[model samples]
Target chain A: MDSVFVHKMWNDHELSKMINQDIPFLMLSDQDGSIGKMYGIYDEDSGVETRGRFIIDPDGNIQGFEVLTPPVGRNVSETIRQIKAFQLVRESQGTEATPSGWQPGKQTLKPGPDLVGNVWKVWKVSEAFND
Target chain B: MPEEFKPGCQRPPVKKIDPETAAGISNESVLKEAKPSMVKVGKPAPDFTAAAYGQGKFVNTSLSEYKGKWVLLCFYPGDFTFV
Candidate 1:
């Protein structure tokens, strides 16, 4: 996992200490903001980056990504949830696709030629989970 | 005495840009040139190498190192700043 910050490495350490929790992931300092520029999140005027999150599959393909304004914070739990859902779908070899708000131990839909345009008839949204 | 709570007490002032300056700031065109031509879902992620702090050590790493594993790239504005 990558955590890119538009600051110096020293600031990264200081922030980590301020948070009182060790950042568990690899934290990169894009001081020149080149990475941010490449990702299309760099704000040239302010010399800062927007909050961007990308989920990549095992094959290095981007499975999903979200970009938020700098004033908005991202939801870590939601990111984890998406990772879990993506992993499950990848493990199933594309045979199954998770429905909206799907979680572990929930029913997954099997996508096939026959299941097209008839998903609602086979799977009931109310009966899928207790959420 | 209890202190009164005010919303946006610490919020920064919004920057005001003139119409002419704002119109000249075609950020989209600059971003398009900097970004990869084909950046989207199912496309290979842009690769880069940099020094990272992790596992209690500073090590040079690259996106290629995480091949064959699920990876999440989280980019934020700055350190110790409110999102």
Candidate 2:
């Protein structure tokens, strides 16, 4: 939980230097931990929220969420990969399914009766970890 | 009486569970209850309106405003936390 001023300074001085550009998305300052509590990330004792990430789709439904401790860091590349995977699945109307570690322009599976037991034959372990 | 403090132990007996105190603490006590997240996949994310900083500007932002967009919402412990 930080203030808008803190967010501004952090973004300008720290985040920008690391990424070479400011974060392109809205960065809300949950000073009171109210927003964090709503998302179940607020720690009452620390008065801070756990590092959390939520991917909400266009329909406003939470597609994925992750909460991690201080020592471990979240992955932006993984986030982007999941976003693309979710988008592909949504656009295909659930027909296309992404395997673990799926990336854009990679192979997507068509989920149906044919794919029920033949996943191993078509998708290799190498392809999923190809990237 | 903890097993390690029962006596005949090689190391010094623990007097207190507090690490800061004279007794060296051990991870034996029950911690806080771990509650599951309220936000679930495929469920509607709770709407929130808060003061926000984005792209070098301070503004009031809300979850509802991004209705037709895919958002990768992130929350960290605090500012200057290198995470």
Best by TM-score: 2
DockQ of each: 0.35, 0.35
Question: For residues A27-113, could you state the per-residue lDDT of candidate 1 as single tens digits?
Answer: 787777787777777666656667888999989999998998777788888899889989999999998899877778777899888
Interface quality of candidate 2 as DockQ: 0.35
> What docking tier does model 1 reach?
acceptable
What's the C-alpha lDDT at position B54 in model 1? 70
List per-prediction Cα lDDT, in the order shown. Answer: 0.73, 0.80
- Chain A TM-score for predicted structure 2: 0.89
Best by lDDT: 2
Q: Give candidate 2 misplaced runs (Cα > 4 Å).
A: B1-37
